[model samples]
Target: MVSENETIRRHEQDAFDSTHSQEERNEHGQFATPYDLARAMAEDLQSRVPSDSHVLEPSCGTGSFISALSALSDSFTITGVEKDSSLSETAQRLWANDSCNIVNADFFDYASSESEQFDAIISNPPYSRHHHLSQSEKRFYSQLAVSFSGVSLSGLAGLHAYFLLVGTGMLKTGGIGSWLIPSELFSVNYGEPIRKFLTQKVTLERIHFFDPENLQFDDALVTSCVTVIKREKPGDGARAVFTYGDFRSPRKTISIPLRELAALPKWQHLENYEERENHSGRVLGDYFKAKRGIATGGNSFFIKTRDEWHNEGIADEWLSPILPAPRSFHLSEVTSDASGWPQESDIALLNIPRTASYANLPTPVRKYLDGCPEKIRGSYILRHRSPWYSIGNTKSAPIVCTYMSRSDSTPFRFIRNKSDATITNAYLGLYPQTSMSEEELDSMCNMLNNIPSDVLINGGREYGGGLKKLEPRELMSLPLTSSPS
Candidate 1:
């Protein structure tokens, strides 16, 4: 007869194998946590759990938590479950030499059936949304959340929130749990349910926000935070420790009173508290509607310099005065001619005409249009009554910023528009509402120009070839607007 622990491991492995195919795991964002991160999270929980307490790692990818528990001499019982079959098998193999109970079933389903309660729960659950869940699975998890937290999570919420909610149900009264979840929950709209659960359902102990500059996962691009909470009666004066930097060795730590955290509508406000204070005057959202520049399906095929157009006899109407990638433009004050065209600049805007206007095109331009490839002619731009060469209204905004930039260079730098050329969709257009004067705009531009490079580097996201993209949402969230008047 097999030992109890071995039997449990086999049962878990068999269940996993029966349920998940290899392709399904990859689609579900099923990357297992690194050993170091698992160990660190386990150690943090171990420090909080009483001796001999039962600990559950729901959605446990391959028993990293089990391995961590094995190292402890607290007489603790560990119950680990993984939904992915391959990972569950790997977990069983890694812990083959050890003694621990492992389950190879979906934790969401298991939690619904079982009434067993644990002294502690720890997990790095899946990050995918309801789209990954079957219709029935979504309904099950949705009902579970509504029953537990009284708040309905958005369908867009990742699978991890469900794990957190279900895991909360499996915990014995006064049991503490640590979750390795995305830092975005503290800030995103969909994360409100998770936040509400953390604030009201449990006594949140601490939140460790990792430095975005040093991301945790090689495959995942998101920032992460470790949330520790205990099941207890909701009470006032519950304080939460906020630590930033290395979890093993933090650089900055703040103990935020729970009252303050609950009072704020947005938790992202806490990430950069100092910046928030400095820019509390007025938000960019208060005065302007910020939008991304544009997204051409293929920039290489679409954007061309004036020389390239002239040498190839490409129709001027086929090009638009698109701002070169942020690197190419240096100045701030862009000037357009009386016709709103860039004055005497080699940078020509792509300007295709509508079908009605096409008949009026010059001979050279008409010939060029006729010579276009069949593939190009069939594109969405060409299919429209107006072709891709047709430019949108040339209305220039008072201010423009590079939408994408690298961290190593500068943070938020203003472009001095010395050139008579306009930008394409690679820039951010800042259109002022009816709120501020010209003097204020000039002052705002100067203030933005002087923003420290470090702040800019931290705020932007990276791309290949050292490229970085800054969305209006990210830019608007910055604390710069909070600066003292």
Candidate 2:
């Protein structure tokens, strides 16, 4: 009977989903949690808290967690906060007779007035990226993060991290929190704070990573996880539980000491890592030093085809040949033309060396520099540089790599660069370090391509649609066939 009602609620959620476009929801970070997944999380939390515990959902959209808890037991005192008026009203109306209170307010605002107030907090918080926030908002979230866990969260963190950590303060010392969030939180650089919060600030009971290929949310492209954390600090010799596959019937499980878990660079690295790490002491870092391609203050305004650059009356000295994004290239290997431009495209970066004098520049070049948009000129990357127009590090790469790939195709590709032309931020420049021979490099590239991308990229970042990102450092750590010294 409860299952039947949940189905109805899900249908109602779909009805509301039509009112707003996916882009709107993405900006608001308002993906609704599935009823079954919410129920599974609630069942875990339900076992930890007292029957009469007052539970809070910090970023509840349409009461998925409330419905889950209600189905489990009527004894749970349920309160959910939703910022969207339409969804908040719908949640309030649906659970009016079920003893659930749906508060239409921002979770951050609600959190400010409350602390140590709930026995359990079950939520699928907003996954809005950091860019959605204003500077003042970022400052507030960062400062609060430090206050909560003594862990300085990166400003690059998505909105979900703030909600996850802020809720920790609202819980009683032993309260349980079960959040349904994207798996990105376990591997991204910004996720370091979350790992620390779990192992240092609280006890992580279990974190179950759903198979990326079988995503839990049909509407979202991201792989999801059930992060179950207890409010109390980790105890001595505490072992955090790690699980994979379906929550009810996980395919694999591992328990690592909380102390040891905290030491790992990424929590997601626990997936088939040991079995895949079979290698001589050397990795790609031994043969090549991976450097990310240059970043322009604004790609569109600063980068243009040679024809486009010439038309603008800018001198060739102000332009440097650059490889376009990986999507633009059809072949794995990039070759150079007689003029040193990439054969694929005539794209060139606006190269103004730091040592170049702005006063002695040509009129056309000065006019071009002056024409830089205010937004681009004031960009974080540009403003930090000594000369706002200066963009160095444009050098030929011996070998390059495409960072991400679809699950159906190869996970990563190592492209041999046959060009003197450099690359943009689209690729990683793998410059030879150990005087690796050409045949050895070819063999190494073949070996990397042959290894299962999942095995090769284990412990790295993943995205929706089974897309995986190989960080510059991750590229260096990749196992290599080159003989170790």
Candidate 3:
């Protein structure tokens, strides 16, 4: 049995989804907050706000927070601001009987124009990727951040950080704010500005990270966290509490002095970290030189399975054994057969020559090249090469690591490559440094295979839909906590 409110909310959501394409939602960085999460945040917020306090919800999509606010016994006035007009109207209709006002306007512009101080401001701000904003908008926000928070945010920081900074300006001194944001802020370089502001300009309170394995939003694949902050500067020797798991009752919590947090480059490292006396450590880059695999502009046209290659009569000389995509095999160690092909997988890349004599080539090979479409030939990767089909150089490396994965449990898989096979850009190849001898290859691979899951999560960046990605630089920067004998 569905309640009237739930049915109405579903219809409104359907209308919103139908009117806006996925691309539009992505561009605007709009995703409705889950009701359970909203209610939980509102419950936590109750203790912070004074009686009859005026509250503001920035970028409120259909007023999840407004609905949550109504559940409380406190008599408070709330203002919900949303950029999307239709969503604002829907929220307005839903909260008609409550002391809620919905404004359909850009939050940044509204925040700038307002002189009213809010007792509290809560939001699940848009996570707009920096690239999505035009140069002028980014520049404007970057400047405004410095003026408001005394921290000049990098252009690479997401729009959510800007919202946090701007919302702080609207809060009355000693007021609190709670934000639902991605966990990347603990690890990514771009989050430095927000970190600095929290340390210097405002009172850092608490952070609750949702268990990475259990995603908070079904539509979003990001590891989410709720951050609680106060507008007032911290007292001397102040500490911030960081918790992992459900906000209602976290799995673990750690208290760190604000001064120590300001010194750390990666906040995720704060978990279970103890300072070792006189212990020195090196990063993965000191042991290995990591490089991303070759990228063929078009995988569909150039990559072929074993049966497809055999059926097409592709010549052996023009084919190179290529490892299958990450999902195809589940082995930590890959071995090769007599033909130097990966025994666990059967895939080949159509490797063409830079200079070829068409008349002298086998009839089958020539026919295949003739069938190559203009689009494939003109692809960005191939167009620069002398022959469009000629692929970049590739060689087998002793170890490989997956660049991307959807599973938080195994976001990065290390592989011991006992095969003379090249990989696509989907993987990263790691070669031993000068100090690491070939004798240590087996030990190195074993160590990589056993790296703790938490270490991998802290070292990599997460995308929407809980996808984890690690660039060659980030992989190289991983701190090696264990050594091979």
lDDT of each: 0.68, 0.80, 0.80
* Residues forming the 10-long window of minimal summed lDDT in candidate 1: 458-467
> For residues 283-308, could you state the per-residue lDDT of candidate 2 as single tens digits?
77777888888888799888888888
Candidate 3, residue 325: lDDT: 86
Error of 1 at 387 (Å): 6.0
TM-score between model 1 and native:
0.79
- List, residue by residue over 1-485, the lDDT tens digit for candidate 1: 32344345446545664577655654586655666777788888888889788888887776756766776553777777877677777776666443467788988777778778899988888877567778777788889877655668887777888777778777888899898887767665677777776777678898887766555665555667788888885688787788887887888877776667776545542555534434455556566666666544345555677788776676555666656676665666566666555553556655654543777867666776576667766776557634555545544566788766554556455653433355567677777767666667777777777766655544554432344455787667444644323
The most accurate candidate by TM-score is 3
- For residue 420, give model 3's deviation from the true position in Å: 3.5
Expressed as tens digits, the lDDT of each residue in 392-473 for candidate 3 is 5868887899978877577788888888888888899998876555457778877766667767766777665556788888
Error of 1 at 161 (Å): 2.8
Local distance difference test, candidate 2? 0.80
Clashing pairs in 2: 221-464
**Error of model 1, residue 87, in angstroms:** 2.7
Backbone clash tally for model 1?
32
Q: Whole-model lDDT for model 3 versus the true structure? A: 0.80
